[model samples]
Target chain A: MFPALLHDALTVGAVLFVLGLVGILTRRNLIVMFLSAELMLQGISVSLVAWSRYHGDFGGQALVVFVLTVAACEAAVALVFVLQAFSRTGRLDAAAWQSLRDAEVPRRIDRELPATDAAPPVWPQLTPAGVRPRRDETAEPEREHV
Target chain B: MIAALLPTGTTPLLAAAVASGTVSLWLLLPQAPGSDWLGHRRGALGLVLGVAALAALAWAGRRLGGLGDEAVFQIVSLVAIVGGAATVVTRSPVYSAIWFALALAGVAGVLLVLGAQFLGVATIVVYAGAILVMFLFVLMLAQPSGLAPYDRVSNEPLLAAIAGGVLLALLTTSIGRLSADPPACCTIPSRADAVATAPVGPAAADALAADPLARLGRELFGRHLLAVEAAGLLLLVALVGAIAVVSRGEVAEATRKGAS
Candidate 1:
């Protein structure tokens, strides 16, 4: 029973890890890439917990505690570095720092991108906060759009 | 009905799942110019394929592992996997962070179901409460007003999807080999076997519940004290290092401005 559960849980972790791998490989945004990396770590955490259960010991869980600590530290330090990179380059795109690549490597140029069909989001306007003015009952044209 | 449609063989089911998943991911991934005409239709097809792939994967898992597990485990694991996938695929980084928080919630549920009570709650408090908030702060500080062009186009999406599919197939194939019986060659010998005489399975769970937190504390402080100390030191170093780097960058920027 324990082994069956372990197998199932491990399968879930593998899916998550693969998703993260693809995201990190393809995504250009630095923050998105970091998020994908974190996702991979989450997958590892799940597998570790499952193994700990199977072993009937604290070993896997103990290691997971350390994993959590390392993840926290990595996030703190990595975010700072990301901020520095952003300040310097003024963009979150990883390709912005292509100069860091070896000279012989061909440059990454953006291919033509499709224009988004997504409409701009409209924020609801709030009424002015103050004393309510007395409405003239005789006013004409009660149309809401007007 | 669904069972009838799926192949009885695990290999075929797994292969179908992986192939469909790869295609789904490739379609959903943000790609360059030619994608516009395919737009809404492409998204629909990808969504359909993604659902089919998830179903196939779940079926494969069930076939590989014997059934009769708690329904709650299935539900939470599904939630975690789906949320993790969303976190990877969302175009906006802020939305990606939000999806990650949802994934953390699902993971916490999985942990709780797995009987790691402390780790379960701790995952929520540490990850969703602290680390996730920090991520959100960074995103707010750095994200542009609308979607950045970079977010709309990935690097080699097709290649990435194929690579991911291959990796997943390998991992799943390996995991599927595990059964209720640990193969004699791969039997795990652990501190539990050495220290405790209690029987495993349901009885082991009862033993675990009797004093899991206390036992876990003993394991950490008694056996792994040095490692715990090292982790503490690592955290402190990361703190100081982060602050140092940020301050140094500010100073350099100031100097550069002055020189200019």
Candidate 2:
């Protein structure tokens, strides 16, 4: 009966591991991938504890403690990196951000600046001479209000 | 009151029965309609199957002489299986985390049954206390809106079948091996007895209880003094690292403003 119980636990662990693997393979969302990674960790922990119990030993249990410590550290660092990535790129899609190529910042910045030929003329020819064009009263707000 | 129903001679039998019942209940709970794939009907079927499994395990344990190492092991294993399955099947991350904690506790129970006090305590403290809390934090941070309709994975049936088949084969082989070579002992003192006799807890109450906090004080300043100090230092380091990571951008912003 106890063997059956251990068997069932091992089975559950294996199922979780497979689910996590498939999720990592198919999911495009980074957060989902992260969640999948957690599932994998959980699966391993379950299996380790089961083995420890089967053998009547404490080593496996002690190892699980270290695994937990490492997992916490990993989650903290990964989340911070994820936040930074999201801030840098509005779109979360990995494929869309291909243009952010490494070592091409100079060319990318030059492309962003407006072309001289396409710039709007500062002084229009249709404006009356000598009398400066009346500033659009509605366009400029009352500066004194500040 | 319920304990009275279980005769002294049959205490092991009752415990075994309860353990089995809990395991099956856990297995069947996930198949409930709450999950997207296993519809209400299938979920109901799974529940029925789970109940049946629990009953079967309990009956087997009772017939084989209720008080034995094997009986205890099976009970603990049943707990771990049920908890693990619940953890995976539940959609809510918090629920899953709770299930995982239960699973860890069950594992610790197994250690205690095996007469490994230090291991059991360590498992409870580290896995249940620290790891599960971290899992909860991650789950809360990555909040998934419940509005989205549930979609079962494409190859779920195939994957499940393969995994089930493999597990069945492994179990069969292991069970065959175990049955061929039975252990020598049949009945042993329960874990509670071992704990009572152990030097750590209440047994030391008379000497240390005089100073209410003496046990902890001794641990901190005695044999484990260095380890306690190291743990404190480690926590301090982790705190500093977290602060640095969170405030990097704010510090940069402040510096830029100062320069301006």
Candidate 3:
């Protein structure tokens, strides 16, 4: 006999959705933006479940399963893109990526933006193929700093 | 005249309440550079105002039916809001991810309270367990140092908050009408009533409809078969694409490094 439990649930869902939207609109970190998108998905799922329960129907639950499926796929694709973006630019900042825009449009230049502190990402160098293992006995142990 | 102006229903009250909450939440949201506006004190004020708005609206709704239900709803709702706010406001990407997980957990709790046990458990397993872990892994891979410039500052905080607040206000006003009465189209008969009243049909159909889980399975496969298949196909394509993209990136980087 819970009065307005459904309403409360809906309100909570809406709040969560808006928060996620704010996170997406504000946060520049590519990964955090993705996480915020996931948050928005969670919000929608909550509302769907609430409505499903209110009506005592299973359709909503079934739909949630499909939503989960789509989310999993999206996460996989998004992570790959994030890694690619990170590889191209050492910084995870979304602002660093502007080359994708149309050629007709001039690139945005923020004069006040702070200079990037990190060096260009260095890919691990692989030894020449079929080369014999040569231990550098004279070489000092690399300093281990994490 | 006052009553007419006030619009005597939960809709207006809920709209006002949610508007207050959203504004308070916007105020509480941490800004970059730590100085320009809306300091920590404002956040505290926002918290108080948001809670008060919800309290006042709850009073007007007159739907606080039972103690147990009310208590559970309040706890879960609070968790959801706090976790969501934390997710958005935290400076660190890792912490944001963790908070997002917490918020999703709170959502799952709400789902469970609403009797969508299956969806709740599925959400925990899929979102909390699998997706969150993957996000954490990617986050670590991308920024092993645990600090990044992008993570520190947000873009267009004021503008985004205004847009979010406006959207929340609109949604609250519309969705609040549901409290007046459940949507007539969504009304569903109880399983017992349905089974007893249904004319003798296929025994299998009747049995499937009797069990909620079975009904869900049948509905998914029976009516939404193509959608389910499409979902599975989408997953396969995504998996292959992710693997292909990662491998190609690695190879391209290796060759570039070798040439350099």
Q: What lDDT tens digits, residue by residue, belong to model 2 across residues A9-126? A: 4544554454455444433344445555665665676666556555433344555555555666666666655554554453223333547657754331211212221245578467
Candidate ordering by TM-score (highest first): 1, 3, 2
Model 3: lDDT of residue B30: 46
Model 2, C-alpha of B205: deviation from truth (Å): 29
**Number of the top candidate by lDDT?**
1
Question: Tens digits of per-residue lDDT for model 1 on A27-104?
Answer: 999998998998898889888998888777887889889989998999999999999999988899999999999989
Best by DockQ: 1
Model 3's CAPRI class is acceptable
Worst lDDT 10-window in candidate 2 chain B: B146-155
Show where candidate 1 strays beyond 4 Å.
Answer: A114-117, A121-146, B1-8, B65-68, B180-184, B190-209
lDDT (tens digit, per residue) of candidate 1 on B1-260: 22332234677888889999999999888765456578567777998999999888777766654333567888888889888888877888999999999999888888888888889998999999988898899989998888889998899899999999999989876665444344679766654564465455564544355778887888799889999999999999999999999999999999999999
Which residue pairs of candidate 1 clash? none
Which candidate do you rate higher for lDDT, 1 or 2?
1
Candidate 1 chain B has its poorest 10 consecutive residues by lDDT at B1-10
List pairs with backbone clashes in candidate 2: A2-B74
lDDT for each of the candidates?
A: 0.83, 0.49, 0.74
Compute the TM-score of each model's chain A versus the native chain A and list the values.
0.79, 0.62, 0.69
TM-score to native of every candidate shown: 0.87, 0.46, 0.77
